[model samples]
Target chain A: MRRTSPISVYLSLLTALLCQLFPWVGQGVILRPDFMLVVILYWLLRSPNLCNVGTAWFAGLLVDLATGSLLGQHALTFSVTAFVALTYQRRLVLFNTWQLLAYVFALLMIERVLILLLKLFEGNENPGFMYFWPVITGLLLWQIMILLFGSLTRPKTN
Target chain B: MLKGVHQKLEPQQSPAFFVRGPSPFSRMVFFCALSVSIMAADARFNYLSQVRQGFIAALHPLEVLANAPSEWTRDTKKYFSEHNRLVQENYALKEQAFEQQIKLQRFNTIEAENTHLRTLLNGNIPIQPKAILGEISHMGRDPFTHTVVVNRGSQHNIKAGQAVVDSKGVIGQVTRVYPFTSEVTLITDKELSIPIQIERNQLRAIAFGEGNNTLDIPYLPTNVDIKVGDKLVTSGIDGVYPSGLAVAIVTKIQQNPESPFAKIVSTPVADVSNHLQLLLLALPDYKEDELSKVAPIETTATKKELSNKNTALIKNKAKANAPH
Candidate 1:
């Protein structure tokens, strides 16, 4: 594993925030990925020493502020997701490519479900089935992040 | 046993001693508690509004940077539009302006007559609200809520509760004001309710947002005098919206035998997504005017009392002068 700097994690998180802030209109909004969550998960998995639960929690707060929803809605979900990711950090080295993908998918689903529960509790409308559309897009974004930054698992040897 | 095995197996696998200050579970618990308190405080109090405003103000530059690409694309598209389209648009606008001018002429006489009639009835003059034109910076980031951010804000003299309207009709009301922008909650949001009167029969009722692109007018009798095509306009009773502004058109009416109230649904007239520009009407300070009206009534009562006293004195003087 390459030693990473703290600045790189923060810079990448800021770039993800910019992507999240992009104006998405009409039907496209439903498909908008949780860019910050995917990026934060990447750093948390890659360098837990530098990107910890506190980093995820702060990033979630920024998401909450940007979305202008209730305060701490995203923050709570993000920290919970970070905890799950960190708990499984030691076992990631043994995970194959498919297993890693499944792990990321579960994390994304956890974040989405947490948000849906929060929204429902806050008395928002059911938002229909389309509310889960972000999960699929977020999965795709996670794959892209892995492709760009390299995979978290070791290469298979014959 | 697994912990002993793991610790005994790999010393290098553990995180650096300096970097691992606290357990992830403890950090997660602390953050979760902190966020829950913040959520409780934010939902129950107004203390965080100032903090939210300052943070949003600081984020303005970043938002502008993010918006640049879309703005550039729109500008390029506008610049590349064909000349014929511009001419056609200009022609249509000219025709619209001409028709509006003709209507204004009739409106002037009607307004004068309305003033004269109101004065005869000792009614207070209606205040015409001043308006500021603003462009929608973006739709609300949260899709679950129906809100839009307008470029006008506290810096632009925008106050919460101002009426927002498009050319077609009332759009919504300003709910929050930041430094360089304000949040306008649309008429379709669950929290907003408007006082409306049917245009056909002048039946007054309050319509609430159902949060599903329709307004619900409940509490009306199941056999109320309303139809599917009836138009709803501002009743002006709440003093927020002026009378006769178009609000919505009745779309569905469901009368349930089991329930006492009718399920009347209406769609707002303003196409919130169709327009980029909207008008924010300034809030009317009618309370001060109402107080002034009360002051005049007191003065008039005192003057009447003085006249009654003078009349009694004159009557006594006449009796003295008549040598009775």
Candidate 2:
């Protein structure tokens, strides 16, 4: 197995941040995926040593700053999501491709729900069902990540 | 012999496999606590504004890069625009300017006469607020808030609380001013409210944003003379917005017998979705001497009296306008 360089991890995370900062107008804003979350989850599951809960927390902080949202809102949700992903990292090796995709989808949903809860607690109006659109888009990005960086599971030696 | 040799080799544990630092639970707990504290401080205090400002300034280069693609496309489209369409637009603009010039001639005399009358009545002169032109850089990132970021910021002498308006009417107010960009919270945001008066009847009321592209005028009586198509203009009593600027037009009114107060809703006149340019009106400056003379409590008392006088004056004007 090739060792993932820490620099590459940080570089990819930065690129994701840039994508998150892109100016999304009209419908694009609603359909925009959580780019930072997808990238962070990918690294956490593939190489826990290189990208851990701390990295996720820091990336969340950057996102919070960039989005101009309440401080630490994303950080808190992201750290919780990272912890959940890390808890199942070992078992993921035993899971097939479909199971791994389900796991990723669950993590994305968890992150979205946590954010919704926090926003509601902050007295914001309920964003409605359209708020969950990002989960579907984030899942698509997850698949893209797998394609670009290779899958987490080891290949069969046929 | 092989079993004995393997036993003698002793259990070899690779440090890399077991060196996962702190457990995930502990890390999660630590980060969660830190974030909660940060969130609390941000929500309840002013310390984080500076941090936010500094970070936004640092991220400005990245924002410009991200915005480059859209800017290029817009420029490209403009470059390919039809020459005939441009000529027609230019002709229309010229005719509009000619009509406005004719109105300006009459407005100049009326304004001068109004100042003279104000001096005769010993009323304080209204201050003309200057404005700075700004372009909308982009819509706000957070979907919960109806805000648009303008390119002008503190560096350009932009300040929080400045009234923003398009050529048509009032748009919003500048809520947060960063180094190079400012966030204008639209009048459609729930957090904002504007003091308005019915242009037809001069009935004064406060309009609160409904958050879904409408304004709600709550607490008004069911019998209040407001009707659909009535225009609402700023009263200027709050001193934030200039007087008589068109705000919203009444669209829907529901009189519920169960509820004492009528449910009045209106849509804003300014359409931000179609335009990119707006003017940020400077805050009206109060002279230091004038401010010192009036106590805060006395000011509030006078403000109440002034509103009462305004309503009474409106009634008299309405009565006079009626045919005997």
Candidate 3:
């Protein structure tokens, strides 16, 4: 695996933040992936030493500010999801590609469910089933990340 | 010698395996607590509005950059429009303006008559609210709430709580103001409510947003005077929205026998999706100091009335006590 630096990780995360900031008009917003979450998950799984739960929390806070939702709604979810991902970090190397995909899918679902619960608590109307579309889009982005950055599974090296 | 030095450096550096600080559980607990407190402070105390505004101001440049592509596309589309279409549009606008000007001439006389009549009755002068034209910069980031960001903000002296209206009717009210942008919470949002009156009867009631593109009027008797297709307009009792502004049209009135209150649903007249430009009406200035100074007699009258009520209450209490 190629060595990664903290700066590159931050740069990629910022680029993802920019994408999130893009003015998604009309129904297109429903399909827009949770860019920051996907990027933070990538770095958290790949380099947990450099990117941790705190980093995910901060990114989530930025998203909260941007989305103008209650201040810490996304932050709490991101931190919890990061913690779950970190718990499985040690076993990730042994997992096959399908298993890795399944794990990421679960993390994305956890984030969505957390947000839905928070929204309900805030008295927002149920946004309906389309709210989960981001998870599918996020999973696609995760696959692209794996394809571009190489698999998280250790290669069979002689 | 170089290889020996590199090997020595590698051994001195902490390996990635040992570099993970503070277990994930602890970090999660700490961040979770921090975020919960932030949410509490934001929701209960409103201590974080300034922080949000400062962050949004700092993020303004990034916002502009993000909006640049769409702006360019809109500008290009405007540029490539055919001249024939432009000329036809201009001709239609000129004819419309001429008709409006003729109507405005008659309105001037009616307004003067209204002021004269109010002066005769010693009624308070009607405030002519000033408005600033603003364009919708973007729909709100969260879809669950019906809100839009306008180009005008605190920099333009747009204060929170000002009523916003489009050409058709009332759109919403300004809920939050930043440096260069403000959030207008639409009347269709669940958190927003507007006082409205039926145009035909002038029966006043408050309309609450139903959170699904409809306004609900609850607590009214099932046999209330409201009917489907009744026009609802601002009552201006709360001094927030100006009186008589078109708000919504009553669409459906459901009288369920199981419930005591009638369920009247109305969709807002403002087409938030059809237009981008809106008017942010300036808040009415009813200066408390001026009213106190000018209406001293009125204040004394109210005070005397209150004192009389207090004495009557005390007399009743003493009568009951004496009997005991």
TM-score for chain B of each model, two decimals:
0.82, 0.84, 0.83
- Tens digits of per-residue lDDT for model 3 on B174-292? 88888999999899888888889999999999898888889998899999998899999999876668899999999999989999999999999999888789999987775222322
Query: Which is better, 1 or 2, measured by DockQ?
Result: 2
Among these predictions, the greatest TM-score belongs to 2
DockQ of every candidate: 0.79, 0.85, 0.76
Q: Backbone clash tally for model 3?
A: 0
Q: Which stretches of candidate 3 lie over 4 Å from their true place?
A: A156-158, B1-17, B287-324
lDDT of 2 by residue, B1-324 (tens): 999989977797556867798899999999999999999888766468788889999999999999999999999999999999999999999999999999999999998999999999999877778999999989999888899999999899886777899998999888778899999989999878888999998999999898899999999889999999999999988777899999999999999999989999999999999989999998776522332333311223334554576689899999999999
**lDDT score of model 3?**
0.88
* DockQ agreement of candidate 1 with the native complex: 0.79
lDDT of each: 0.86, 0.88, 0.88
Structural similarity to truth (TM-score) of each candidate:
0.88, 0.89, 0.88
Instruction: Give the worst 10-residue stretch by lDDT in candidate 2 chain B.
Output: B291-300
In candidate 3, how many Å is residue B130 off? 0.8
Q: For model 3, how does the per-residue alpha-carbon lDDT over A12-71 read when each residue is reduced to its tens digit? A: 888887888888877778998899999999999998878999999999999998888889
Better of 1 and 3 by DockQ: 1
Task: Candidate 1: give the clashing pairs.
Answer: none
How does chain A of every candidate compare to the true chain A by TM-score? 0.96, 0.97, 0.95
* B197 Cα displacement, candidate 2 (Å): 0.9
Task: Between candidates 1 and 2, name the one with more favorable lDDT.
Answer: 2
